[model samples]
Target: MEFTRPLPAYLVTRYHGWKATTYAENHAWYRRLADEGQRPRAMVISCCDSRVHVTSIFGADQGEFFIHRNIANLVPTYEPDGNHHGTSAALEYAVTALKVAHVIVLGHSNCGGVQGCLDMCQGRAPELEETSSFVGRWMDILKPGFEAVKDDPDMPRALEHEAVRVSLRNLMTFPFVKEAVEKGTLSLHGLWTDIGEGGLMHIDRRSGQFTVV
Candidate 1:
């Protein structure tokens, strides 16, 4: 493999700007973080969508949240089959190593991954049905979510919310996460954001409804 491509000029310029301004102003904080290591109180699992800025949504500073991003923000069930599990790896580290008190799954409207899952479930996305498609396989984790919302008039929005629910349920499958929750050391949260309106909805676990926040 060849590595010839360099960082984009715009990104390089942005990095220099941040390093000079934000980094300079917070020099001591950055150094302390580097020396003491991160001890974020919460772990946010969010979508890979660029518009869904987790830190910005909460107005959090650097080193405040341990975030993991993936398509549809899906979390597969605990499978210790020894295969590569990026999401699972992050969950393990956050729960066991970092001992984060809160685990938040943040979903958003107009999510491409959710749309892809919708299409695949409806038999419209034949490509995603192929085993060779990594994204297709990953989105398969949300098939049940699709089923739960397939009959709804607002399928897209419903599925997006269901995705958060699915991930929350799957998070409990991990033994460590379950233990922490049972011991009252950890909590799980599900949130859905409306991208265009910038409104947020919080899931009520007992009622299984997403109410405005």
Candidate 2:
């Protein structure tokens, strides 16, 4: 499936502009971080959707947050499969090596991956005939959220928010995260960003609440 416009050429051209501006504007900060051996204090686990730009959405600085992205903003339970688990591996590094204070699962509205999972949960979508496709397996991570909130009238919205919550729940399955959370060294968060409406909600674990930020 190739496009007539061929985006690679446009992207390469854009990179030339970015290289000039970014290097001229921010290379010192990048060098300082390298000189100090610095790492970010937070880790953001977000969806791989192009519309949800985590850095720009949060107004982040260069070294502000360690990022891990995947479809549906998922974090699977710790599994030792032969295949590489990119998101989980990032989590392991962030928790153990980077020693990040906070780990946030950021979900967003109108996520196709979330929609697919909900459709499948409602039996409107089919089971995975090909167990090996990336999205087929990634959407499987949202099942617990659907099972938890399937009957709600706002099942779609609820599923999206609950996916963030359950992925936060799933984050605890990793031993380092579990230990860090228990000792109060690391805190977990569930966040939702509405791209269409332009609002962000933060989960208050203490009150079982989602407050606008």
Candidate 3:
């Protein structure tokens, strides 16, 4: 196969800047991570949106978080059918291998993927109903979330928060995760971030509401 596109000049310049600034300042820490291997304390599942900066939000450092990003940050039910499962694979590695103490499902405001699921559920996106659409199939995992919030006055925002709840429920479906939770070795948390105002909302397991944090 022949490649056509060249690297963007702006990205190349930014890489050089990082190498000289952040990389230089953290050189020893970077080398230690490379030699000692990563043992992140927490696993964070979040959206693939470029605007959702997980590190900046948590003020995390290198080797601090085991992160996984997917459409709507949704976790599907455990199928174990010997097929391609990215999210499940990450979860397994985080729990069984890395032994992350906490797993957080981070949803955000104005998520395009959640909006797509909402549109599909509302009969607006007919193409998403087809079998060939990858995104449509992936977003299907959030269908139950949309159903729960379909009648809400603010359907979009409600669905965004619901995605975190759905993911938290799905995390319990995995045997390893369930065992860890039961044994008090691991814990699950749900969070939603407002994009515009930068306010954080945490899901209260007791009240089932996304309360401001």
Clashes of each: 0, 0, 0
The model with the greatest lDDT is: 1
Tell me the TM-score of model 2.
0.89
Q: Rank the candidates by lDDT, best first.
A: 1, 3, 2
Estimate, for each residue in 80-127, the C-alpha lDDT of model 1 and write its tens digit. Answer: 999999999999999999999999999999999999999999889999
Q: Which stretches of model 1 miss by more than 4 angstroms?
A: none
For candidate 1, the lDDT comes to 0.96
TM-score attained by model 3: 0.98
What's the TM-score of every candidate structure? 0.98, 0.89, 0.98
lDDT of each: 0.96, 0.86, 0.95
Total clashes in model 3, counting residue pairs 3 or more apart in sequence or in different chains:
0
Please, what are the lDDT tens digits per residue for candidate 2 over residues 1-213?
Answer: 554665688898988898899877988887898898748889999998999998898788878899988888988999978778898899999999989999989999998889988877667766542576567678888888888887889868888998888888889889889999999999998899999988999998688667898
Pairs of residues clashing in candidate 3 = none
Candidate 3 structure quality by residue, lDDT tens digits, 1-213? 477787799999999999999999999999999999999999999999999999999999999999999999999998899999999999999999999999999999999999999999999998999999999999999998888888999979999998999999999999999999999999999999998999899988799999999
Q: Is candidate 1 or candidate 2 better by TM-score?
A: 1
Model 1 residue 158 CA deviation in Å: 0.5
